[model samples]
Target: MANDPIQQFEISKILPLEALGTDISFTNSSLFMVLTVGVSAAFLIMTTSGRGLIPSRLQSISEMCYEFVADLLRSSAGSEGMKFFPLVFSLFVFILMANLFGMFPYFFTVTSHIIVTAALALLVIGLVLVYGFWKNGFGFLKLFVPSGVPAVLIPLIVLIEVMSFISRPISLSVRLFANVLAGHITLKVFAGFIPMLSKLGFVGVVGALLPLGFTVALTALEFLVAFLQAYVFAILTCMYLNDAIHPSH
Candidate 1:
């Protein structure tokens, strides 16, 4: 058993599969990913399956999710971005589930890994770039060019804009990874102290209660962070999608 907080993230294979020349094995991370997807799918399906005139509690919750995403898209990206509701909604649910799933005991927090988040960030940036170019062609170049800059400063402005654009994926990925990693590590460290203090008799037991209390508080905060990170990711994705729609900005 590893006492190190970071080492706990390792995902070992639960059930190995060897087929068709490819090592399509299933690891803990893979299992969690499947679980997240399944949970999300079942949630949406069950909530929406009975769409009645008098909505049930589950139906209301589903409708709330739909309208929530709809409002976000409409407000952030406007009418043109409505077509991308599915993509944005899916991103929200997936990231939300990923973050929540990682909070479970004995589960690997995939979102805690930069590679997983970075890949998702890259996908968003890639979509923005591809759509921007496809929609506006050379006009998309305007994103890097400001209208009010002096001729001598045009090069510098464009360079800065380009750098910021390039850094989007890194920033997006790091934000989620750092939050989840820090929260989990904090929880683990506090948990470790509880057992260590258990041997100290009454005084130590009393002292351990403080950390236990803090850990409980922090757990609630982590849940908020999970949803907040998901919303931030989706919002920033929408903002970037806005650039695709109106590249002149």
Candidate 2:
């Protein structure tokens, strides 16, 4: 059971709650979320708390994180998008940590779950919609209709645009969820082969190296996927926000 990677995703209540339906649940996924947030927060805060005239090693790491996210936001969303720094930064760090945390011996990866990813995706999408409407009011509807479309083409164009707009959250959620889920599953299948391979003695050891090496290589690849998945999520969010800020024809 300890060797089973999927067991990491199991949910268990740490403190039973009859009130809000959840009381200190210590689910694997929940634990991972808490761990990711706690670790990420500590990493950032401790790194930057020094505020040195000349940054020390930790300070340099902190500055790099800031510059990395700042550059990402500046390039993807521009200066007007600067106000969303906290949200964007949090999203990237949280997802990155979640993906990385699962690589540990007994930690769950919340990002692997569709529900968790969907909730985050919806949160971003919801915010984009709220901000868009607040900023543009009914003019937001203009996003669905091309500025120069002939009357005959307006309906078809608006229909397609509306469908695409509605699908944003689904696409965003699935991309992260699917990637992490598949990667973890593949890791598990390879790891499971060890027991069977071990029973064969000498040849078993030799055969076992196949899965062992694959796991090692895949683990490295997973790290890259972790970063890429986070980047993809953030960039897509920025693109959606851009559309909201300036609805295209």
Tens digits of per-residue lDDT for model 1, 1-249: 455777767768788888988776798888888999998899889878877889899888888988998899889899999888899999989999999988888778879888889989999999999999999999999999978779999999999999999999999999988999999999888877888897899999999998899889988999999999999999999999999998886
Best by lDDT: 1
Model 2 residue 5 CA deviation (Å) reads 5.6
List lDDT for all candidates, in order. Answer: 0.89, 0.84
Model 2's number of clashes is: 0
Give the Å error, residue 117, model 1. Answer: 0.7
Model 2 scores what on Cα lDDT?
0.84
- The list of candidate 2 runs beyond 4 A from truth reads 1-5, 20-24, 148-150
Q: Give lDDT: candidate 2, residue 111.
A: 93
lDDT of 2 by residue, 1-249 (tens): 656767656677665446566455555566668889998899889877878899999889878877888888888778888888899889988998898887885667889889989999999999889998999999989989888889999889989998998998999999999999888888887887887798899999899999999988988988899989998998888777776777654
Which residue pairs in model 2 clash with each other? none
